[model samples]
Target: MTITLVQGLLIALLAMITGLDCWLQAFFIFRPIIVCTLTGLILGDLRLGVIAGGLTELAFAGLTPAGGTQPPNTVLCGIMTVVIAATNNTSPATAIGLSLPFAMLMQYILLFYYSSFSLFMSKFDKYAAEGNAQKFKRLNFVPLIIVTLSFGIFAFLSAYAAQAPMHALVNSMPQWLTHGFELAGGILPAVGFAMLLKVMLKPRYFPYLLLGFVIASMISFSNVLPVALIGGVFAAIEYFRTREVSDLKEQIKDIDNGDDQDGI
Candidate 1:
């Protein structure tokens, strides 16, 4: 399934927008799930796109940067995953492993982008010192444009040129290795979940966490949306219950204060 020039350009445009959205708009189009779905749409395979996006999204969910470090590039990873799956007619799960290298590569690209853009800091300082708001704004916008084009060009070329070689490589791999990749892809998301739990679990939230696990285990995977809705309902209940309890405690404290004043 070869993508035409037009389709390739569209994919590039999506990449640019998603990359820019990460910092500029902060609208989260760079997220794996959304970007993958958009890529799938461009490739004329929405179902596969969603599946790839969702799996990758889970794998990437807990990978947000901390301490000034960037995480793997989900925008590039997601697009490549869907592209690989669509091109090779492989399972979306398998595409996860296939796209991993590209994700890491994009991560390095992002680091380089930051380092290169950092050179403009002196120019920005100069503009600021001179009170040249126009040059300052131009300096800022220049990096953004370059970053967008970098993302666009990388995604476009990867999607356009990598498909044939990638499919060939997968086909030539040993059966064991192929299976290993599939297995790795399937379990990758669990790592993200474990990371999330490590960060978020607390003694007070244990019950809710266990309940969520129980519900997930009992439900069919296809029914996750409904299960998520049920969880949302319970979460709302818990929130309101906690709020009311806090309010009641505050009222009791107020009453006690009133009694003290009367006694005085």
Candidate 2:
């Protein structure tokens, strides 16, 4: 489907806001899952958008930015996943794989933008030396505005120009290749789960994880809301249980200290 210019602009604006939240705002509205769902809603395919977004979230869950190093571009990956899936009738896995390269490219683009923006540091120094608060604040915002605008332009291009090429590529794929991609996509989420477990698993949480798995096994895959609710309840229980334990320990310490004072 061809995106109208106005729709394209709206999408670009959404992308800019989403990208800005990723680092600048620290709000999670720009996460891969959320971005994918939003893109899907915009393109008239919310189901595909949600599935792709959720799978992509799992795939990237183990990654995070660390000092000078940035993770792969989740915003780009999420947008491309929804776009490809909506336009090309591709499996989530195929769309995910297809979007990986572009996500990497976005990472490089961000790096370059940051590096180039650093050239303005001398201007910041001048403003600080002059005690010009207005200029300093404006200079501080320059990188944010530029980066946000760049993300919007990239989103617009993807929404507008990517359809034809992606359609052509999908149409040319052999049946076996298509089936293979579907199979790969089906397993991709497991990889994401494994990676997440690797990072988040601790001896203390092992029992909780096992309990979740056991409860999840009894439910059908189509029903997730129940599972989520049960998990939330268990999490709350654990939180309160831990808090009580800590409070008891603190009281016991207070009593021991009081006894020592009485002896003195």
Per-residue lDDT for 16-69 in model 1, tens only? 999899756578889999999999999998998898888889788677764355
Q: At residue 25, what lDDT does model 1 achieve?
A: 51
User: lDDT for each of the candidates?
Assistant: 0.84, 0.80
How much lDDT does candidate 2 score?
A: 0.80
Off by over 4 Å in 2: 2-10, 25-27, 32-34, 41-71, 91-93, 111-131, 228-237, 258-264
Clashing pairs in 2: none
Task: Give TM per candidate.
Answer: 0.80, 0.74
> Which residue segments of model 1 deviate by more than 4 Å?
65-69, 115-118, 225-230, 244-264
Task: Give me the candidate number with maximum lDDT.
Answer: 1
Q: What is the lDDT of residue 125 in candidate 2?
A: 93
